[model samples]
Target: MAIRVTSEHDLIIEGGGMKIIDGRFGQPLYPSSPSTNHIVLLPENFLVSGTEQRISRRDFLSVLANVTRVMVRASYSTEPSAVYRLHSFSMQVANPSARGERRASAVEMCSCPPGYAGTSCEACIPGFRRVNGNLYNGVCEACHCHGHATQCHEVTGHCLDCSHHTTGPHCDTCLPGYYGNATRGSPADCQPCTCPLNLPSNNFSPTCHLGEEGELLCDQCQPGYTGPRCDRCSNGYYGKPVVPGGSCQPCDCHGNLDLSIPGSCDPSTGQCLRCRQGYGGAACDSCADGYYGDAITAKNCQPCQCHTNGSVYEVCNKETGQCPCKENVVGRQCDECMPNCWWDAERQECMPCHCSPHGSISQRCDVEGRCICRPGFVGRRCDLRRQGYERRETRRPVERVPIDTVQQRWGGPSRTGGCPRGAYRPKTGPLTHGITTGGQCVPCHCNSFGSKSFDCDETGQCRCQPGVTGPKCDRCSRGFFNFQEGGCTPCQCSHVGNNCDANTGQCICPPNAIGERCDRCAPNHWGHDITTGCKECGCSVIGSVTQQCNVNTGCCLCRDSFRGEKCNECQIGYRDFPQCTQCECNVSGSDSETCDMERGVCACADRTGKCSCKANVEGHNCGLL
Candidate 1:
């Protein structure tokens, strides 16, 4: 079996996988390549570290394994060198006299471990990390991230950048407010709580948590609201606040009903359920015939002040009390503004919302008419520029992150075999001609037509054909387009910008024109004027198939049986244009058979099929007189 290193902490021996057979700490390492994004592991000289387990070369090559991020430290080896050779004292040279013999020592061979190399076993290889001790004393071990994360801390082995809603030192559990089995390592193992009255904009609860029985529960309801979903109002309130545009207001009983017990007013309407001390009326707003003064109002009956915020408040009166609400409010002691209207304190009025039609989420605005803008746009009314968005910019395509482990969403263990899909362990070779041959198993990202080949180097840098740039060879250089295997062709359009369709080499057309060079008129217009575009064909519906035209003559092709310039009339011998028919007149008795219109003695009456007869002719066809 062949073996080689493909990245800073990975190896490839079989099955096109970038896994590590083994490694040790404190090896002298240099930068792998310019494009690899690998760091200078260590200086030319480094320490010789220890390890926990020792394995033979056979065990290392047979086992499929992996190594994660690590660090390199320095320490000197203290072992003394030993020579193992004997010298002969015989005068083998051509000097036959009694001459002194000179001796020489031979170099010895060392058989170090799989992770070590050197005449004296002084340096350790990569794929292992050690935080303590120098090379000769510290140990190195493989890193694991519990399948929930792809990477971990270099110094510590803690998992980082957790996914599938997991969080912890090892990503072994789900985060707060989420429930389910996180240890299963599946993306759907954990999930959000399904609240009963849940809404996209108005979730009345602060959070939903797991109950004692492991069931999801909405625990935190806002003030004046209660229930599992914060949908119901308290004893003294009314209205279905759970629904959109609904709010809970205090009972408008005017203090005529006793609220010591419960059910003093209607749950939806402000009408009192039961009046107190001979009181009667819709909200008990007036005393009964036998009742005395001040039965509806309290002893010191005064207006209960209100806290006018953006949302619903507690204090309230009847439907039309007109208590003069807060700055932006007008509901009888209510604090919230009406739908689609914002308060204008300077003018003391509620004006209709004026938000940007394209940028704002809705017409509703804040007290200052400030709208909630969409992403990449910002302003009080969602109309101002947001830096890079000042000019119309095309949106870039989105690239998704690669997943290392594959697991079932519903259930089951993870599936592991090699590097992530769309990735491969590149072939290993010496660096040559400013090109990196091998380093990592990364995505083979290259343009189909712009690159020389789809195969990428270890650092995922594709080889471009010529004028193609970008690491993926997806863009053309010098404002060129129509990229192909050999190179990119120069753009031919007059209004082309930096980019265009790389494969077609077509020009970006204006809204009113379309063609290879944006010189042709649109389908519904007819003219060469790009400024005003093509004028609308205005083709007669009974004549045109496209209901529009693109011809330079500014007219539509007439349908069968039609002849007028606008195609609105029938042909010479026919009557109804859309449902035209041939004229059949009696030839022998008629004056002429050709519907002669040149002299103005019109034809076989176009509408009646009657023939114009000669002199002495009287009957329909001049058969009798």
Candidate 2:
């Protein structure tokens, strides 16, 4: 590479073998021309041999910084010859086809090569990092960030903005939950690990890697699933992994079996070996044949209590314990007769007692079929009103209620056997509730100021606010203080601080800190840092303009004639620090001054009080030459 020595010139490229010619004139340089020799044409201000002797290093670098475009030949010769040009990786040059064959362009410039840039390929592009201390070079390679980053460090070539679970300077390392060759430089090189199947967040396996044969080997499986590939259920767990979208499920014996003992049920089918007492089934979820009531919850099953004479079957409903009764019979045990009917012992059936529906509390009568009467009505049918009781018009049979309001209340005894809509489960309730949308119960009167929200969990414990403590969130946490309505304020006493005052919320500040927050330097100090704290100004009391300094840099307010950060030294050509006396040496005869202000050193004329005397005449101050 050649650089111009002055502002009047530009850089030049060394032309050895192949080179580029002007497109307008290069087309005529065919091999069939009469002349074979080509004359050398040079750029403007080019130094011909025997014209200029040397070039300096400083002038060479100036050429590279502001290089102009390269130019083709200015030769006057008309002879045509086969010519070559500078070709980038993508640049293709094709000689004109034989005379009559379909013609083609002599040259085509697709684009600069991967790492090359500028008009004459004078520099590297953004995608490529500099190798020769940030300058033009042909050996630069494209940015290799393993497809995780588009840009790299300009000086170090370290990749930046790496994504897709990648890390390291070149983004060639895979993060957890991923595997494959991260250095391949392709987006698909690194892939997510899947022991059995892939999922967005949680997976059956926690650690996996590609095996020697390229098969996936899971190092460890998450709970609820087992096996080398996490393809099978663990002991006491059940699932159908043979089918699509199937995940392992726990045995869930519902407190019927001792969970502490392993292998309580079949891992594939979830069949329990035995039940606690009245519970029996695949998961011991229902009552046995001889038992009734809930077997899964409450576990309060009782023996069947059906009346032998009225009930049709020996067994009752296992859940609700309602027995199958004969016709015209009602009650839990199926022993009572229906309304408006009486039992006939001889016929083993019920007989109806027809009564006036308007005057009687009910249509039923005595066992002998004699109709009973209401208080205000008379006769066996009770159709007539008595003495002072006047008959009123009766609007019989009310209309049905709307279906929307006929829904059940959550956790009501008759509805869900739990709690009310506004109330949550009792404290210390078992398991997360799927019944409530929050998966936990919440109650009213929960602390709104100190808690995360006005809600308590199933165990009746309120969620504490951020940086809060105490059961009722009345106190600040370890790193916080000054608790009030909104919340507590965090301590900011720098890294050296241990604690703060609880009531006042004042930070315990470091020894070097002057501010309460420890965010700024002390008076006469600067450059406050968390680890090192504030550094002393250390300025010279006499040489400094003032005691003040830059807070972040600790740079002193130096006097006009002083140099150095602390203003302790005088400027060049000065004599003293505090006084900063200028050197009065004359360069014409005294030579250049090398003043050491601290020692009061300066090159005076003749190394004496006055100038040296010449061969003929002499005086002082070099008056005679």
Candidate 3:
């Protein structure tokens, strides 16, 4: 058992065995021993005090139990011991012990309630709180609803609904021109107010009302009208709504006639007769001068009909249709002219027949009726004939001949020196007489070198050099061959055969072969002329057009001048043998040169050398001379 001494009193108790005491007026202070390891004791009222100065035995026992429990708890909280040993002892209890034990005080355990946490169980759950100290046991007594407060709480302090013109959780007031009903929700419900058309209002709310004459409410006067009611004309009218005492009045043209004369209609006469000649209108405030069309019209006088021509009637004073002239002429109509001639004022004519200087011409009159002299011959009557007349002749100068005409005539070389090569002259009359050949008259020679310079006299044949050809060797080369004045020039590599054809430089390639160089042949042809530089072939065929022709095939592709199996004979158009040298003359009197023997026709030179004619009259071979 243990004893507890409080600040006010002390307590004692017995342990291991408990005893009870009965009171005359109340329940017993002691009960049976505590069945559990720990027990608690509390006063019914915290303000009450014990009657005795010391604690009762039961209370002291309760405090001992608490102290034991606290010790056991503390011991359990410590780390376990590392070493251990055991000792055993036995004793028999013949009689129950009546001894008391003392122990220290103990503490009580604490447990938090639902929705509350902390050592004292004082705080409420999340999202639920107490404000202004109005909550207990973690329970809220009041709570803010929706979104109406600046600071919402589950207890006490909370904001109410917002005002009509204010919104948001803090009751923020809306600005002018804005309105809303959103107190606890989103701001989407807010909106601004609008006013009617032409009836603007700065106030958020506007009301409608009736205007004068049942018109809608208006702000200001409209055009041409005035007054608050807007029911009267401004001015310039003779009516009621704008009477003298009202907002507007009728125009007093009489008193306000600062621009014109004033007059009025006569009631008794029933006519607008009381006005001046130039005044009219209700108060004679306008022009009535029969309007002469412009400001120049007189106030009371009639308009002057001035002529458009600025002649005749300068100004029509009377209302008559005819116009009168102010002076001679110079008016609207043809009514006047100068006083010089027969003055016809109505016709504005003044005929003055005057003669010009050259003659009595009626067409030369001046504006004043005077005549002018004609050009080149001047006189008043213009009838005088001038003196002096004669005929003259003009001629161009003739050129004279100079004495050096003889030298100019015989300018060129005589005879041989002036003669052209390849042309001949007879050794007769002119040569025998030894006349000097002058002025383009010169003898001709066949040799290009000189006359009779390279001649073959006895043989009567031209011994042409290697590069020279032609009858007299006048031409260095013949046919398709070319020369540079003296000797024949070699042919281009692409040209073949003895001479290129006159019209074209293409080779006369043998049959079964082709190409400008004669280096190619048709398929199936074989020959050394194309392969071995113009070598003769000894194939089985003597002269076949096909390569390696057999004896049975005979000749092929005969020479142009001949036609035979061995190319040994000429064709019908050819006359001579061997090379078939013969001429062929056409009906036009043109002839071909001697032909090649192996070909079918003559190989003639076209437009080149002289020819052996078919009907000769003189000179070479077939001639008659």
Candidate 4:
């Protein structure tokens, strides 16, 4: 098959025919001749594909070694049909039109073809620009006009009548909220004005118009609305209205038509001019009933609150709410209670009627100042207890009784009952008419732990339980045992803690004196007694062999040389030695001076021996000195 590198040159179509050209001039490497008709143009260091023809690597390299440039037409293959077919697949050259309608010869030079451009008419036109801009075997792409127009200006790329919302010369840009044509035509030229999804359709205008202001204006404003976009309510009007129809409502101003000044009221605020007499409020419609002061201002009124419900009529004076009083009730506004009924400021009205001293409840009575007494009480003022009525016990009430006759009655056994439990009656004279000062039965506050019984003696002393000896029986009794929190537990002294102090819980210590209960004597001390502290056993190094001494009595352990109980004195055998003096005798001598322990001396057998006697010379037994 023949390969046309360009319209000017064709690659020779022959068996295993291969070639290369100098890419710098884009021409054949060797001059074309009849024997070698085809040409191949390649850039420096180009890769060659030989699978199409099965050319060996060695043959392809040999052809690429020498590259040249030329402009010539030659025929290399004698098989014309295959060459023509190959040209149809890869390239197409046009035949020049005959001037006189004569048929053109096949041998005539081929002309540049349609849809092709460039010097050799081998490159696809601009509308079908090459992919990758490569001149060798590069595919061509048809120009995209963005669907706005069939074609675009070849060089400037300016498109005509860009599609909706699309703009730009190449129709490649989209308008805001629109998918096409962003740079051409007016902002809304191809854009359909739409309402925001959040805005209600009923209140918003039906259609949108985008004008020179570059703003979208609804076709018509709803009634009661006035604005460039008709999105806001007009003055004196409120609420969102339907498009081109509904209007806002004007403030009724409380419907005070007579007092309100015409056209003087604020449409939006509903505030009117000066209010009429006996009227107040933003609309001047509030009746100044039971009010006082200026009725024209917003804070015009003050309450009247008639005294004692004495107002002649329900409505009070126009200027102030103060009302005139009736003769029965007093005070400027007749707000005070009558003489019998005291005014209760906190309760804001006449309080309970003032009854006499013996009133049952807190001075509460009928309109009159009479007393209200309990069931058993009777009198004009409930001051006297009924003759036949007996006293009844009751818890102390919050209010004090005017006169407590029951509490002052005789304390001794009454004809009825004596006294309540936990209480005692005071002693009285035998059937005496007069009651004693201490007549009331009183309760004794004795501690439960101490008192054996709830009753108390006439002197008010509680009887204590066993093992409880305090005046209140609150502590352990002397010699009692087991002391704890419930009362005083006695000491478990075990004979050693005898006669213990009940309050301190300390028992008399044992004779040996030591332990907490004084049961035993401590280690080094001894000879303890109830009256005396333990004595320390004295053990001196000089008197005793070891520090250990007798634990029973205050005595030093003695050594062999020591004889006294405390080891301070020596034994009789060693009377003269402070530690332990032993008797000494002179065997050689036969004087009468016997061995003397106290002096550690033995006289010589006779006075003639000088060492036997102390100083003077003596006779035979030291009898004569």
In terms of TM-score, which candidate is strongest?
2
What stretches of model 1 exceed 4 Å from their correct place? 1-147, 154-158, 166-184, 241-250, 253-262, 274-281, 284-625
Greater-TM-score candidate between 2 and 3 = 2
Candidate 4 C-alpha lDDT tens digits along 66-144: 3233223444334334242222223232344446665533232325455456443436764555555544444555556
The residue-by-residue lDDT of candidate 3 on 458-493, one tens digit each, is: 222344433456666554443233432223433333
- Candidate 1, residues 479-587, lDDT tens digits: the string is 4665533346655454534334556666666557677766777776676554444566777787555566547777667775565555677665556556666555454
TM-score of each: 0.25, 0.27, 0.15, 0.25
Give the Å error, residue 424, model 2.
86
**How would you encode candidate 2's per-residue C-alpha lDDT over 468-520 as one tens digit per residue?**
77766678887676664334656544354536777786766655775667677
The residue ranges of model 4 lying beyond 4 angstroms of the native Cα positions read 1-442, 479-488, 499-512, 530-533, 539-541, 546-549, 553-555, 573-625
User: Candidate 1 at 333: error in angstroms?
Assistant: 35
Global lDDT of each model? 0.53, 0.59, 0.36, 0.48
Give candidates' CA RMSD values in order: 53.4, 34.7, 49.0, 44.8
In terms of lDDT, the poorest run of 10 residues in model 2 is: 1-10
Question: What is the alpha-carbon lDDT of model 2 when measured against the actual structure?
Answer: 0.59
Clashing pairs in model 1, backbone N/Cα/C closer than 3 A: 6-439, 7-439, 48-135, 48-136, 49-135
Clashes of each: 5, 1, 30, 39
Whose lDDT is higher: candidate 1's or candidate 2's?
2
Give per-residue lDDT, candidate 1, residue 522: 72
Clashing pairs in 2: 19-85
